[model samples]
Target: MTVETIDLDAAGVRALNRRLQGRDGPVAGGHFIVTNAKGRHALAVGLTEAMDVRIRGHVGYYCAGMNREADVTVEGNAGTGVAENLMSGTVRVTGDTSQSAGASGRGGLLVIEGSASARCGITMKGIDIVVGGSIGHMSAFMAQAGRLVVCGDAGAYLGDSIYEAEIFVRGRVESLGADCVEKDMGERAADGLQTLLERAGVAADAREFRRYGSARQLYNFRVDNAAAY
Candidate 1:
C-alpha cells in the first residue's frame, strides 16, 4: 500500500483533506502519517473512503469527525469531540480524550486506550466504544443503541437517561443514572463482553466486568417514574 506523510505546518488541515478527497493521491486507499499534528483541530473530518491513518501527536477538537470507513490511530491525546458522529470504521486513541468523545455516532467502533472526559457517547445511535481507563461523569447519556465497554472506572450518573445501550465496566461505578441500573451478567452477556474486549484489544477478562442497562421503568414516564427523572 502507498504511504503518504503530511506535515501540518507545511500543509493546512483543509489542504490535506482536499488531497485525500481527490482519491488520486496516496491517501485514496493507502496509509497516511500525520506529522507535527500539534493539536490541529478537525484534522481528518468528513472522510468517506477507507484508509489507514496515524496521527503522531495530539489533536484538537473534532478530529476525525464524521468519518466513514477509515481506521484512524491517534498516538497522543485527543481533544473534545473526537470521532463525533462517526458513520463507520474504527478510531483509536492511545491517550486520553476530552469531553463528548464519540457523541452521536451512528456506527463503527471507537477505542480509547486511555481515560475519557465527561459526556462521552452522549446520544449515541449505534456505536461501540471501548475505554481502557476511567471515564468521566454522565457517560452514555441518552444512548440509543450499541455497546460501551469500560475497562476502568466510571464517574457519577453513568448512563443517565439511557435507552438501549449496554455498558460494561470492570471498575467501580460512582453511581447510576435515571432508569439505569445494574444487570445480572449471564453467560451470554459475558460472551458478548468478551467479544467486544477482544475487538478493542483489551486483555481484561469479561467476567470481571459488570453490566448496566435501562431499567425500563422510565420509558412511559408514569407519575411514579417522575422521581426517576
Candidate 2:
C-alpha cells in the first residue's frame, strides 16, 4: 500500500487535518503517516472516514477525539483525553496516556499498551477499552456503558459512581467506588472477557481477572441512600 507522509512541523495542523478530512482536495480514505507530531494537541481529531493514520511520536491533548470509522494508532505516548468520545473504529496508543482517556466515547475500541493516568474512560457510553498496564485513580468514574479492562493494578476508587459499566481487573484494586462491587464471573462473562483480550492482543488468563459493576443502589435518590451519594 502507498503511504503518504505529512510533516506536522511544516504543513501546520489545519492543513494536515483538511487534507485528511478531504476538504480542500481529494476525498480522504488512504493510509497516512504523521511525522514530527512534537506533542501537538488535537492530532487527527474529528476524523470521519475509514482511513488509516499512524502518528509516529507523542501527541498532546485529545488526540483522535470524536473519531468515526477510522483506525488511528499513536506510536508514542498520548496526552489527555486520547480518543475521547470515539464514535466508531479503533484508536490505539502504543504508549502511556494521560487523564480522561476515552472519555464519553460512544462506540468502538481503544487499546492502550501502557498505563493510563487518572479518570481513564470516565463517562464512557459504549466504548471498550483495554489497558495493558495499570490505570490511575478514579478510573471509569460515572461510566454509563461499555467495558474497561485493566491488565494491571487499578488505583483508588475504581469505577466511582459508575452506572452499568463492566470492569475487569487482572491486578489489585485499591478500592471500589460508591456503587461498584465485585461480582461472580459466569461462564458467558468469562468467554466475553476472553474475547476482549484476544481483540486487544493481550495475553492473559480470563480466569485470573475479577469483574466489577454497579450495585444499582444509587440509581435513584432515596432518602436512605442519601449519605452514600
Candidate 3:
C-alpha cells in the first residue's frame, strides 16, 4: 500500500494535525508516514480516525495523546506522557518512554517495548499498558480501571491507592502500595494474560506473572481502613 509522507518539523506536524481537525477532522484516513520527528513534542495529538501512522524517530511529550482508532507505531524512544489520556487506538513504542506514560487513559492499548519511567500508567482508566521491561516508582497510582502488565522489575510504591485495576508483574516487586495485595491467577485470568501478551507482541510465559489488585478493604471510607489512607 502506498502511504503519504509528512516530512515536517515540529510546528508543521502540529499544523497538519490542526488542519486535519478543523471540521470533524481531516479525512487523511489512509496510511501515513511521519519522518524527521527529531524528538519534537505532540507530533500526533487528538487524532480521531482510523489511520495508521508510523513515526521514524524519537518524539517528545504527548506524541499520541488522546488518540482514537488510529494505530501509531514509533520507531524510537518517546518523551514524557506518551499516549496520555488516550481514549482509543494503539500506540507502540519501540524504545523506552519517559514518565507518566499513558496517564489517565480511558481506553486503548499502549505498548512499551522497553522500560517506562516514573508514574507509568498513573490513574489509568480502562486502558491497557504492556511494558516489555521495567517501570519506575509509583506506577498505577489511583488506577480506577484497565490493566498494567510489566515484564520486568517494578520500582517502589506500585499501585498506591489503586482501585480495581489489575496488575500483572513477571518480576519481583520492590514494594506494594496501600491496599494492594497479591491474588491468585485463575484459569480465566491466565488466558487473558496470554491474550494481552499476544496483543503486545511480547513473548513471556503467563505463569511467570502474578496478579494484583485492590484489597477492597479501602473500597469504602471505614475507620478501620484508615491505615490504608
Q: Which prediction has the highest TM-score against the true structure?
A: 2
lDDT of each: 0.90, 0.93, 0.90
Task: Please provide, for model 3 over 108-163, each residue's C-alpha lDDT reduced to its tens digit, 9 standing for 90 to 100.
Answer: 99999999999999999999999999999999999999999999989899999998
* Best-fitting candidate, scored by lDDT: 2
Cα TM-score per model:
0.93, 0.94, 0.92
The all-Cα superposition gives candidate 3 an RMSD in Å to the true structure of: 3.0
Residue 107 in candidate 3, Cα distance off native in Å: 0.8
Q: Which tens-of-lDDT digit does each residue in 139-184 have in candidate 1? A: 9999899888898899999999988899999999999999999999
Candidate 3, after superposition: displacement of residue 214 in Å?
0.6
Candidate number that wins on TM-score, 1 or 2: 2
Sort by lDDT, best first: 2, 1, 3
TM-score of 2: 0.94
**lDDT tens digits, residue span 1-229, model 2:** 7899999999989988888777876635789999999999999988888999999999999999999999999999999999999999899999999999999999999999999999999999999999999999999999999999999999999998888889999999999989899999999989999998999889998999999998887856356766875
